[model samples]
Target: MNLETTSSWFLMAAFVLYCAAFIGFVLAVTGRRWADRSPEQHQRKWGWVSFGISAAGFGAHLAFFFTRWAAAGRIPTSNMFEFMTFLAMMTTAAFLIIYALYRSPVLGAFAMPVGFVLLAYAAVFPQEISPLIPALQSHWLMIHVTTAAAGEAFFAVGFAAGLMYLLRVVNFKPTTSGGRAQVFFVELTIFTVLAIVGFVGTVFTFKGAGYEAVFLQEKSSVDQKGQLTTTEETVTYTMPPIVKPYNSEMVRMTPFLGMKEPLFETPSWMNGVNAGRKLNTVVWSLLTAAIMYAALRLILRKPIGAAIQPALDGMDPEDLDEISYRAIAIGFPVFSLGGLVFAMIWAHKAWGRFWGWDPKETWAFITWLFYTIYLHLRLSRGWLGRRSAWMAVIGFVVVMFTLVGVNLVIAGLHSYAGV
Candidate 1:
């Protein structure tokens, strides 16, 4: 098979393995009773099996990336889909590194799911050949994009850990009976259910609705050859119809009245710009609002326990929190050097400017700032445990914007790969 075809197969395999790993991780966490009843030999065997599966998936991802690079005759960091693939790979690599140090399988529970989502989203875009523009042809493209993505991957892991920390803090009492454990389990279930429903709602509302074209008319009077002539110009707006209720794609498109030509037949560049604008204004706003609402709810919820308590019978909250901090610290310098400095250097060489305030660049800066603040808060103000955890969670939003939102929702010069 051609390299592109091989890469596709590899990605497919990686996605399947990631899904299986996620299931295994969840089983390890929630099915503790079964593990407890099993022999020690059985637990050790399953742990090795889980790690092997994850490692195999990571290896497949690496092959997929390298094959794509070979096929393209250049690096595969130009577009959203490629960027996401890189991000998934980085997350796996970072998780493995952290696991080597801490031996915490709990982290896999979140990392695997996040990685799966990223790879799945990467599949949305067309996997055809991506012709390199002159600006993206430099060697710096590889270093800049890869390192930045690696840093973001670490932050992604931090986000998962922070979330788990929050759940552990708000619901469970470390020293008490199973009351806290029950609460933690219930909260996790609720979060899972809501995530599923929201995903279904978004998919049905957005993707299920087919594309439509809208038009506007403008009239102007002008003097032509000593006579007054009235002219009417029609402007066209094209997008998928908006779904009203959850998962409803039955919205009717407005009839196309008098117009010079169809709106959507304009070049692919114009289509991308238009779609980017719509996503920036409409979709992003709703997402921001939803996130703010969730944050507020989390803040208002009373903590069921005070002071740092063991996450589980033998797990110390301080150790988990420290690991989280270390993860953030390691990720920050990588982000600074890779996402900001290297990217700026590459941008200067390619686009004749160090910083263009392009959407991708802007979001990368945002991600850097978020983490900078996170580090600052952790050190200067001595914000550890829950506060630090919250910052870590917020940092993921910035990372997500940098990784996915900029490509999907914002128009810029880096709009080569299919998002």
Candidate 2:
């Protein structure tokens, strides 16, 4: 098989292995053991198994990546799909490193699921191989984007550990530290993760199903003779419909949901067929995830975090908190080098200026600022424990917004998002 086909098979196999690792990790933690005594031998044994399997999966993930790199003739970080997979890979590699340091099996239990969800999130994007765009055809694409993504992956580890700290330290009931907001975000994070899972399932289940709709784009032009002429362009998607013509006179060729008029028209620049379809897919994904979440809550009769708290009893809240901090400390400078410094170098090469305050660059600044403040608060201001953990969580959210949100919502030179 060609490298592309072989890498795809490896990717599929890695995902399957990750699923097994998640299950094994969950089983290791929640296996029937007495709370009064220390963790059972079987629990620890299973934890090793989970780590080994996850490591094996990471091997396949790396193989998939290198194979794709070989096939593409560049590092596979130019697009959202490739960047995301790299994020998953980095997160897993970071988790393994942390595991080596802390030897906390349950931490793997925590971090691996986030990695799994990241892979799922990556799957939501188009996976076909394509030629690199002009701006991305540089060695810096590897140096810049991959380093930034790797840094974000460490933050993902912080997120997992920070989540564990919350589960261990925070109370769902009212507290002086604005506990209600914490409770809500904690729950939202759970939903978001499950939402990612729901999105992957929804997307993949319909693979090979050539479902599509079309929208019309019209341009009115004035000739040198002062006569006006209008031309129409057709856009199609295998995904759901999102944007439509603003003019009431122009209707959708495919009347999705039986609505002739759209809720609002997309701005001409932001109205690319693929972009609009991706947005619509996002809406469907959230709706699907919401339904799944509701059904899950109905069956469980309690918040998922509360349910998982019991299994987390053996893990130290302080250690979890510290690991989150260490992850950021290690990742921040690398993030600065890759996400900011190298990016500025590329910007100078590509745009003839260091910065234009474009949405992606702006958000990258915001992300860096958030983490910088996090370090400032921790080091200079003596902010530690729950507050630090919360900052860690918020920082990763900023990172996420930079990674995907900018591409989805904002239009700019770098907003192509690997498609």
Candidate 3:
């Protein structure tokens, strides 16, 4: 059928399927809890039901993506929304594989919500039906972007597991019941809750108090007319020393500040878009700060009692730590080969350079370095278990910067992937 018709249908189907998968994950967590008190038959029944629902949801999600690609007559990684969908699919697939191997439904309980949030974020932006730009019209576009997305998906899972390990280790004690599993579950819950709160707050702040403007200032300079005069010059005019806007309110709030002044402006066509995004960022930052403060207060209220109780019983700390390390071992190579090596190859072919210090490229290198150090620490420094888990957490933070922070905060060749 028509592109619009097909795209709309696919978007709707993807949303419904993701919601279904999220519910299935929640049910699976509930079933795991019930396994302790309920009959074996009931536990197995719910487990099977949960698996089937997730499987079906994942199938629908894949179909929606492939159909969109077919309708567009090209690969679907040209923009932020499509990239999000692709990443969500890859993450779900990876989570399912891990679940199959380890038989840990708890991973799904954490991963599905993250996938859902990303898909929902994708839906917030309008999907444009346009031909790929010449730079992205090559086959490597598919290979490079898809592989990078897969690597990102794996890192996302690693992040979830590492966070779980951290919570378990920090609250360690020798006598509490289900302490291991409880710590894992609590960590997942706290991460999910904070993410949601942060996202919502960002949406509200950007919607309420965001502004867009193009600032200009007078500078001491000689014009082309050959007479020296202080006159209004466009921000792009750099030969006579850049003009600096004097309004403190504007200077303080401008998002593209350099050492001397703001270097970019929100063009008329993009003013609303930039303002909205800025507002979202501010709101999310405030919300995150608030959640962190509240969590600290709650933790301090009964510090020893609260911390020592949940980590008393459950899985072995060493086992959890080992799992975290193993997951990173599997993901790190993929990230290096896909996000770095292949990306450079594509850049060389498309831009006549192997490396250009693009923001995306820089962040990718940072992520690679972060994980390389993690591996080194584990192998050479005799760091394992808790220390290794902490490294994995930090590595994932670097991965996040590579995947999201660079795209959002820095402008470069990969700007197309930001909304």
Candidate 4:
């Protein structure tokens, strides 16, 4: 097989292994929860087996990453598809490190699914290799994006640990308002997870459906007098048009819904085709979430979190809380060094300026600031337990927005994020 095809096979193989790992981790958690004390030893055995499966998957994932890098003739960090795959791999790596330190099969139960979902999500994006853009053609691209993804992977581990801590700490009955809020968040997490998985399934199922939307795209050309002039033209897209160049006249079409309207521009700072696609993708996620929620309710007859809550009983919430906190503490400096410091240096080298406040840059900075606050609040301000866990969870959200949302929702100087 050629490089792209070969890399794809490796990627598919890795995903299959991830699926097996996910199954193993799930069994590890559920088996321990329901087993008698005598069978508890069996739980330990299952946990080791689960760890082995994920470790093997990690090896496969690593190979898949390098194959893509070789095919691209550069580090695979230039687009959403590439970075998502890289991020998933890093998250797996982070989980393995944490397991080595903490020896918690529980973390694997939560963390491996995050990586698998991300890998599945990455599959939805077009994966064709392309020539590097001028701004992205630098060795610094590898240094900056790879490091940032590594930091986010640590943050992902923190999120999974924080999530487990919350599930353990939150009262299942939730008679009080604060307790109710925690329960809502737990349910929201379930919703979001199922929705993301559904998104991958739904997007691919309808991949060839030709869901077209039109936009008025603005254009500029030099006039006969050697002056610049701007013009608008109607354009159509097979997906949602989130952001676009200035003054594009896009006509919106959704025959399935029997809706058509004039598509307007997003804020000049934010408008782009990818932005609309991201929004549309969210709609699909929600739809899938609702359907899955209904089916789950029919089968289990309760909120999904309620089913998992018993499995969390007697687990050390404090340990999970600390692990989550420590992961972020470790990740923050790495993020700052790569996402901010190296990013600025690369930007100055590539664009002749260091701090343009592009949308992606702004979000990255916002993410950094949020995590900094999380650290300060916990380390110095005495936050702990549920509050600290929640902070870690929110901090990871900021990281996700930096990694995924900014690329999809905003048009910025960092244009390499989109295909």
* Model 2 spans with C-alpha error above 4 angstroms: 32-40, 173-177, 219-233, 242-275
Q: Candidate 1: global Cα-lDDT?
A: 0.65
Preferred candidate (TM-score higher): 1 or 2: 2
- CA error at residue 217 for candidate 1, angstroms: 12
Candidate 1: residue 103 Cα off by (Å): 1.4
| TM-score, candidate number 2 | 0.88
Tell me the deviation in Å of residue 235 in model 4. Answer: 5.8
Q: Report the lDDT of model 2 for residue 408.
A: 62
- Cα lDDT of model 3 by residue, 110-179, tens digit: 5666676777666645577678877887888888888878877777777666655666556544356666
lDDT of 1 by residue, 1-419 (tens): 78899998998888888878777665655555566476334434554566678999999998999999899888887776788788888988887777677766567766677787777656545567768778887889889888888888888778777766765656454466566664554354334424433443454344455434343332333465676665433332233323111111222345423433322322233333334333422442355446644764577563322222232334456767876787788888988999999989998998789998987788778878878888888899999997888688777866765554555554577655434
- In angstroms, how far off is 82's CA in candidate 4? 1.0
The list of candidate 1 runs beyond 4 A from truth reads 36-44, 172-240, 243-272, 276-314, 407-410, 415-419
Weakest 10 consecutive residues, lDDT, candidate 3?
A: 235-244
Top lDDT prediction, candidate number: 4
Give the whole-model CA lDDT for all candidates, comma-separated. 0.65, 0.79, 0.63, 0.79
- Could you tell me the TM-score of candidate 4? 0.88
RMSD from true fold, candidate 1 = 8.8
- The backbone clash count of each candidate, in order, is 0, 1, 5, 19
Task: Kindly report which residue pairs in candidate 3 clash with one another.
Answer: 176-312, 176-313, 179-313, 202-284, 206-279
